[model samples]
Target: MPARSYLYVPGHRPDRVPKAAASAADAVIIDLEDAVPVAAKATARAAAAAALRAGSGGTPLWVRVNPGADDLAADLAAVVGPGLAGVWLPKAEPAALARLDDLLTGLERERGLPGGAVPVVALVETAAGVLHAEEVCRAPRVVRLGIGEADLAGELRVRPDPDRTELHGVRLQVVLACAATGLPAPVGPVETNVTDTDRLAHTTATLLRQGFRARTALHPRQVPVINAGFTATAEEVAAAEALLARVPADESTAVDPDGHFLDPAVLRTARETLDRG
Candidate 1:
């Protein structure tokens, strides 16, 4: 199954790394970019390397690398290893991802790892990034796509509504790009209001309906909410199972006891729901 929650721990906070990995989060992303200050870049990079060496307690460990040439070089050099699950490329564009793909290729070979072992999650944060979303999604090693709404709003100079309705179009664009490229649904943006559990759950549900299967989480507290939002509820699973059981073996259509018609499409949806459960 696809990841339901990705908890991001700051690279500089090495103490929190293991804790986050052990959390209920489906994945742990040690952020080396944005979260780490300029003066502490080197320190954060070293800390990230150490965290990778320490192991992830069986949880996937990803690193968000800076987009700059120098920092990208330093970050990948420090963190690329067997423990690394993938790289999150910020401000992702096709060209930058090509460079990243080449770098990761060389690093994998040098580290004696299998070729193409490390995947990438391309983060679209700027107007250019949005416009080139499909290209970025299609880039080598890019296994998934994500939106950085906070940064994108800053770039676009638009303050979104409380529900973030204004960014819906961009989010759909990302979803379409992923679908067009045969990639999984995009990971949703991080909900920064750490204390607002209600809002977090509401927005995560909205994202799930908007074609986002997973969401990046800023706090461990948000992990369960996100995971629950993405997962099929027991009632939903039971309903799907019932629908499937009512279908006739030789027919593409059937009628449930409640007189509801079940067609091929409905059967497919039921199967998908069961699979999700």
Candidate 2:
């Protein structure tokens, strides 16, 4: 669960699952909703379940389920067994997540798996959902709070601008809510265009700066850019190490080598970053 760069692969495209599972991404999300048509939900669910069973070790595997759909029960039953890491509950409200929690709990018990074996990642897409994001994040199995910008913009009656000015407030709200709840802040629905690597990198860098722990990638090609953006640069790692090295263990605060005042909180973060590296 280290800060991951998750790439989304359409579940119906089982042929692509192997390549996606073997990709450089920290995790791969097998998508059932939005990516798969209603008619093909069953097929996608089976494909995702098969992929999970194939067992791509090391790389975490998550399945994005259709929220509140009648097919969701079957989807959960198909993929919530062993080898599955977690479920990405899309357009999730607190109530929906609560129900999903119950479903996963039942599945775990029925399958003889450890309790709480599967966690949930809630995707907040609407204004109401974002407003109640804290409650959603606080739900029993929620590991992260995800933002779905496309649906959010449609809900808010706005167009998708390149700079994403319209979604900035909502995105910040999601991040702040996740931070307040001690949950991971999800990154953006970055551009799917493989040719626009520069934009993808820029978007990923911006999200990281804003405290997002992980980002979402629609295309596999965007994986490298997202991973690169989320990774700590050598300079950043060196600076963090240098700051921690200069601080005395007993001293809670001190002036750094650069002559800037460093507080205990700052020193702690520096040490944590170095340790993470």
Which one is best on lDDT?
A: 1
Residues 1-277, model 2: lDDT tens digits: 4645788889999888778878888888899988998789889999999999998867788999988657678889999987788998888888888889888889999999999999888888988889898898899888887788888898899986787877888888898898898775565665766789998888877777776767788778888888777677788899998887787888878897679999988986786566445
Model 1 lDDT per residue over 24-140, tens place = 999999999999999999999999999999898899999999999999999999999978999999999988999998999999999899999999999999899999999998899
Task: Give the C-alpha lDDT of model 2.
Answer: 0.82
lDDT, candidates in the order shown: 0.93, 0.82
Q: Name the runs in model 1 displaced over 4 angstroms.
A: 257-259
Residue 4 miss distance in model 2 (angstroms): 2.3
List clashing residue pairs in candidate 1: none
- Backbone Cα, N, C clashes tallied per candidate: 0, 0
Off by over 4 Å in 2: none
* All-Cα superposition RMSD per candidate: 1.4, 1.6
Q: Give the least accurate 10-residue stretch of model 1, judged by summed lDDT.
A: 268-277
Each candidate's TM vs. the true structure? 0.96, 0.94
